[model samples]
Target: MKKITTRLATMDDIDQLADMFDAYRQFYELAPDLALSRQFIRDRMLGSESVLILAEDEEGASAGFCQLYPTFCSLAAAPIYALYDLYVRPEARKLGAGRALLLAAEAHALRNGALRLDLTTAKTNLAAQSLYTALGWQRDDIFYAYSKTLAA
Candidate 1:
């Protein structure tokens, strides 16, 4: 079996990260927009608003990527990270790329003194939910999440 390696992503990784990000957005039924994706990832990296981790296969191919955004938890009065994205290429599935990326994100959060890491997946994404739970992430059954979109 090929080994997977995970690391913190740098600006130089924007191209690979953008490709994976575009694919991830497409997984949510969004249209493919590599240019926009590249810009978004580049902005995030340059702005230092998010922490990204990349996973590479034994051959150094882009296997997966995960991103974490730091935010304050009002109720808890503490710092936390929102794990906004995680994706593994189709050919990389079942090879532990996703799990590796997730673990790397968690480690980064912990090292940064984050209170906790939070994430939400589509309700129909059972595979992701399963992976999260199996990795000891508690499912929030206490509070219902609501979102409101404002006109731009």
Candidate 2:
């Protein structure tokens, strides 16, 4: 097993995080947009609107990252964290980085008094689903998700 460590990402990590983030978006069938990826990450980190947990090996090379958004779970009337994005580089898979990232994210949320952490994934993404299940993340069978885009 490899020794994977995770920490809250800082501005110093923006470049590496953007590179992996671009790959992650492309994996989901989105077009590659390096500029957009960089700016989005920069905005999030600069504004403190999101939590980006970065994983690395002992060598300090980037392994992967997961971005978390903090929000309130109105039904529970308490703060909660939405794990919006989680990605592990293709070559870094099976190295325990993903699990480390998840564990770190959970710790961050819990330390901040969150009620629970929530996440969603495509039904076809069985690999990710498996990881989440192995980490004790339950599927939301009790509710459906819907969204609409408003034209600006």
TM for every model, in the order presented, reads 0.96, 0.96
- Estimate, for each residue in 51-138, the C-alpha lDDT of model 2 and write its tens digit: 9999998889899999999999888899999999999988789999889999999999999999999999888999989999999999
Residues 1-152, candidate 1, lDDT per residue (tens digit)? 77999999999899999999999999999999999999999999999999999999888898999999999899999999999999999999889988898889888988999999999999898988889999999998999999998984
Distance from true location, Cα of 75 in model 1, Å: 2.0
For model 2, what is the alpha-carbon lDDT of residue 16?
98
> What lDDT does the true structure give each of the candidates?
0.93, 0.94
Residue-level error in angstroms, candidate 1, position 18: 0.8
Model 1 worst lDDT window (10 residues): 97-106
Which residues of candidate 1, in runs, are more than 4 Å off? none
Q: Model 2: what TM-score?
A: 0.96
lDDT of 1 at 53: 93
Model 2 scores worst on lDDT over the 10 consecutive residues at 1-10
Q: Would you give me the overall lDDT of model 2?
A: 0.94
